[model samples]
Target chain A: MEVAHADDVELAHRIAAGDEAAAEEVVRSLGREMFGFARRMLSDSGAAEDAMQETLLAILKGASKFDGRVPLRAWGFGILRHKITDTLRKRGREAVIGDVDPERDAFNAKGAWKHMNFAPWREDEETLQVVRDCMETLPLRQREALELFAVEGKDGVEAAALLGVTPVNLRQILHRGRSAVRKCADAKLGSDED
Target chain B: MDDRIRARCDCFYQVLSDYIDGELSEEEAGLVREHLLLCPPCLVYLEQFRIVHQACGKVESDDLPADFDVVMQGVMTAWRKDRCGDPEPGS
Candidate 1:
């Protein structure tokens, strides 16, 4: 379960009471996370900026409704996710569905591994860049799942709710996302070595 | 790897990501532990997966845009007007 930061709840109350400092606090605390995720989801700098502005405005308008139940950060992210979706919709960019799984060929019909070699990668900035590049290649939903879970440090249930999927479904999405990046990184690194 | 080891590796691969996140049940995780004891390749895979996980976690967040303060100032000004029942500027 995502632990709701008590201070965030308190800050929401203060913001509800028209506290400018509290509002600033929320902005300062969550702005980077929102911007980063938005940048990844909406590659266009202008779209990303629009999404962030809308998100901040929405947070201000909706702060009074904060129930102190959901984590404020997660709630803010939910709003940002909606804004990103709307931005994408306006741009007529919908997520492409039903991409073939690249990992299926790695195993046989009997579900046994093939002769592919899994070498340990050098842990450095260069290899990390490879992994990040592979991550960028993921579908929007999959990359968002990976970012929410692996990057933003959100727990399974929180991430699932934010992604609007069941926990089991979220896990499947996450597994596919991880496998895609891992295999993609492997291929890139192998080519680099060659 | 023999057929038995090969079979274990296959099963372990299925739950490998879950195992890394400690999302597996105790029994499931224990099974993975036992498999790692017998399988060197699986262990290497696990190590590499951890590296990927770490790299993802270490990803830097994008910096705030330079005009963010100006944008935020407008938002706050509007918010203040709303709170004070003030009319829009130049209205």
Candidate 2:
């Protein structure tokens, strides 16, 4: 999935010129990544599919206006961000405004490990199941941040750009996400020790 | 540890992902580096974080479904057809 910059730029040029072949190439190249992002953002398969379609349509309509300053994938992701936001807005849904509670403050002060024991994760089926279960329990925004930055290996700034959030906010999301995942891992791995 | 230094250590860990990814400003990075040198706990935390980070990547990227490419192709075909009917404006 290492798409070279030159290739993306050339494909983007063709797409801007209304080349159907290039459009197909663009979709083929970016579809899964975009779908994965949308799925995590919405946490609903149907909504993700709809959002992906809208994003693709926006790419088709807006291709000609692209200035080519940013990487094509980055621009495409930016378009997807807007499409997802619009879809969410239309559904009358809003992102949760997380509060900083005493528990969070304590966790922050004492270090997350103080509240939980850490054990090495095994590669057994049970271990994998626990990991999956923990991942599913994360809030949508935190999960999206983890998937985009950690799983997809996108840089924080690029991920922030794609999510349409400030880098500071993105950092907060990653921090919270990793902490939650660590807590889950700790709980699951520690159970075997008892 | 001084309370002030401990607070900075917590902030450093909170932003450790950013730090590892080179997202911080030079000044911020220098501050974190200084803190890491003096703080053994935060240093251990960073090491453990890296392990989890690498492990997650290994687990998630394994075993692509055989039909992944096919599924993408199907989606691409439909997407292309949706944009195909527009006559070149000058034509």
Candidate 3:
């Protein structure tokens, strides 16, 4: 989530200069996140591995074009995004599904939340565990959307860019993820209380 | 709740998320803020939603391969060989 812009620029310049150690350091720093990103985006672990390799190879091959203006992570993420997109395309549509009805709420037609009480609660270990569980219940695309936006702390535009969706589409997907998970958590917790 | 009052809170519930993310304009944000001053339930919902998001941010990362160096070396070696071939091809 945090990018050291100045350090990134320096790293990019060094990599562009064909500094092997600098390239290694770049891999050390950004490789894990890029791997995780690809893993989350691709359904196949093998495909994820291929995407990660392609991402690194592309970075090194294209390092000369690194002008240091963009943060190194941004450039790296862009490459990874492209690699993932190509993998998805070559493999033919890798399961982009979504489902959510915002109207399925406890709110009455009068616009009042009837029968649902969203009481303010502090964050506890139990709540965190439940949230984690709820995340597993989301559809693939919705879950990815939420992870990038909510978990990775990327803004709508950045998350959309990573997911290859429009910003408006990202918002809708995020909203669906949030509402679906929130409602599920409520139901789960409510049943537990019962 | 009265119809107008209920409708306003409904709007707040829907857009409170945009408010949380600072997506709402100054005017829309102001209206939501003003509404929150009176609606306790929405304040609760907002807090709950925020906590859910925060907990998600804290979700433990999946286990990555212990040695990324191996993978890096493989790609770097291939990359060098590929780059060694053929001139820059006049971009």
Report interface Cα RMSD per prediction.
3.0, 4.8, 3.6
lDDT of 1 by residue, B1-91 (tens): 2233335566677787788888777877777888788767678778877877776665385666788777667667666677776635445
Tens digits of per-residue lDDT, candidate 3, A2-120, equal 43466766776677776778878877776777777677567455677778888887787787676655566667777876677677667664545676545357577766677546654
True contacts kept of each: 0.46, 0.21, 0.55
TM-score of chain B of each: 0.62, 0.56, 0.59
lDDT of 1 by residue, A75-192 (tens): 8888998788777667775654324555667766666567547787898889888888888777778878877776546357878877778888877787777878888898898788
The Cα local distance difference test for each model comes to: 0.74, 0.63, 0.69
Off by over 4 Å in 3: A1-29, A38-94, A103-105, A120-122, A150-154, B1-7, B59-66, B69-71, B77-91
TM-scores of the candidates in the order shown = 0.75, 0.62, 0.65
Tell me the alpha-carbon RMSD of every candidate.
4.9, 6.8, 7.1
lDDT of 2 by residue, B43-77 (tens): 76666555445544542443334665665555555
Reference A-B contact fraction recovered by candidate 1? 0.46
Worst ten in a row by lDDT for model 3 chain A: A94-103
Query: Which whole-number lDDT from 0 to 100 does residue B88 have in model 1?
Result: 51
Q: Could you tell which candidate, 1 or 3, scores higher by lDDT?
A: 1
- Give, for candidate 1 chain A, the lowest lDDT window spanning 10 residues: A93-102
Q: Kindly report the docking quality category of candidate 1.
A: acceptable
Order of the predicted models by TM-score, top scorer first: 1, 3, 2
State residue A101's C-alpha deviation in candidate 2, in Å.
Answer: 8.0
